[model samples]
Structures are given as structure tokens and as C-alpha cells.
Target: MKTKIIYLLMACILLVSCQNLNRPSGKMTRVERVVSGQTIEIADRSAAVPVLEPIRLIGIQAPDIRQKPWGEEARIELEKLTLGQEVLLEFDVQEKDRFNRLLAYVWFGGKLINEYMVKEGFALAEPDFPNTKYMERLINAQERARLMGLGIWNPDQPMRQTPAQFRRQIGNRE
Candidate 1:
């Protein structure tokens, strides 16, 4: 069992390293819409027909839409930053999620939007494996946001529940 696990781990590492070698140069695309705080739709013109591809911002998770004002605030903030704007998409190890949403670190005006959202306290640093190239940067941004008590970190009206928690609760109810 131990040997099997070791081989599996090695294989995973090898696969990830191979994927990293061919990292996509920033693909410039126009934001079609904001699905939520952490997701956006972009017009992908790579194919014969343009397709609206949903992108899930890597390294951070924002409040769920069911999380009341915090969720809406996050959506609004994301919209303010990205809606109708041309943004650059940088991919890491995994290019897409199980939902087929493109997983990327978004950049606008030379700023990493994923880190910006965490720094602004609009989202929490949620590291997902094999796609954590910017995890430390995001965690540091979250710390700064926490110290400054911005957005969801505000002492008086802070977001009490995490986006994951909110999602689980909603899922249970359904």
C-alpha cells in the first residue's frame, strides 16, 4: 500500500510538472459577465464559433450569493473590476475545473485580480491543490485585508460564514 501511494504521488508530480512546462501565455479576452464573486464569463474566440467560457478565479473563494449582503457586495466589486473589460488569463497546472470552467489567475491593468480580491477582503484565500502557484501571495493579501478590517473582515459587519460553509448549508436544505 505504501509503495502504491508513493508511486501515485510521483506520477501526480510528474504530470503536473509536464503541464507546467507549457503554461499558456496570457490570453486576452473581454469579460462577458460576472457569474458571482469568484466566477466570470468571457468570450472565447479560439474556436470557429465564439463560446462564452466561465472562468473560476484561482486561489480565492468569495462569498456565496446566498451569503446575503457580503455575496452581493463581492459580485458588485468583481463587476466593477472586470465587467466589460479586457483581461488577461494565466493558467497554472490544471486549466479547467470539473464544471468545465476555466481556472485562471486574472490580470487587469497589470494587476492580478485574484490577489486584488483577497487584498480587498472581498474573498478568502482558498488554496486548491495543483493550482496553487499564487497561494502564498493570496494568503499574504488575506492577512493584510484582515489587519485592515476591510470588506468581509470588517469587525462590525464582517461576513460570518465562509463561502464553502454557505454552500454546504444551502446544499443540505435542498
Candidate 2:
């Protein structure tokens, strides 16, 4: 009887932990600024002095600031959606990227901002593993945006290359 009870308890614990692997519930913070389409500065109110931290939106990549009008457009759109708004930051397997930016799925105004950006073609769905909680949704949104020829996906004026590729090309030129 003791052995059976221990096994049952262990199984239940495993199940619960597995369900929370992505850490869906997260810190509620206010956006201090929109740094770019896929990044923002958020106020960490839990700190006594309200420290500002950079948060990189997970599962998507926006045009680099050097990408001409496309980049500026993305930044402006992000600002309109998130600047000064209170947001929920859902974490994933890895908390921060190498750049020390907090990686999160930002929720605001009842929308997943990351996915929305892709859906509207302001960004592209780029899945970074260990943080793919919403990649599928983002990819689907991207497809729809592409089909509709929206924003960056517009056939007549589409962004010439992915942001990562553009960055690499710029680095090579220097």
C-alpha cells in the first residue's frame, strides 16, 4: 500500500509540472517604452525603485532599425499597441537571452502582441526553441498576413530579406 501511494503521488506531481512547463502565468508590468517592434522596456514594479528592463518578444523578429521605412513602421506600430500599456509577460523555458533581455510572450488588450505583429505583417514568425509556447499561432498569423499582402508581406513592396539576413549583410559591409 505504501509503495502504491508513493507512485501515485509522484505521478500526480509530474503531470502538474509538465502542464506548467511554459509558465503561462507571468509578471504583470507596465511598458515604459517601445524599443522596437519585437522589444520593449518594461517597468519592474516588484523592485522598490521600479527598475526598467528590456523585454524581447519571443517567437518573432521585427525589421531592424536600419531596415529603412519598414523598420520605422514596425517600431511605430509597436509603440501604438504597447507604449504605456500594462501587459502580462508569460515566460518560457529560458528566461533571458544572451543579450540579457527577458524573453516573453507579451499580452496586452486581450491580444498576444507578438502574434498580432506577425498577423499584421510587421514582424516575422521566428521560433526560438525553449520558448515556442505560441510559435504555431504566430506562424498561422504570418501565413494569413502573407496571403493578404499586408505590411511587410505586401508583394509590391515586401521587405527584401528577413531581418536576420539583413543584419548579416550589414555586418559584412562594415
Q: What is the C-alpha lDDT profile of model 1 across 28-119, one tens digit per residue?
A: 88999998889999987889999898999998999998788888889999999999999989989998899989999999987899999999
What is the Cα-based TM-score of model 2? 0.83
lDDT of 2 at 107: 91
Clashes of each: 0, 0
Candidate 2: segments with Cα more than 4 A from true spot: 1-24, 45-49
lDDT of 2 by residue, 1-174 (tens): 999999999999999999887445788888999889899998777788988899999999999988987899999999999898889998989999999999999998668999999999999999899888788899999999999999998988999989999999999999
Residue pairs of candidate 2 with colliding backbone atoms: none
Query: TM-scores for all candidates?
Result: 0.83, 0.83
Q: What is the lDDT for 6 in model 2?
A: 100
Once fitted onto the true fold, the runs of candidate 1 whose alpha carbons sit more than 4 angstroms away are 1-24
Clashes of 1: 0
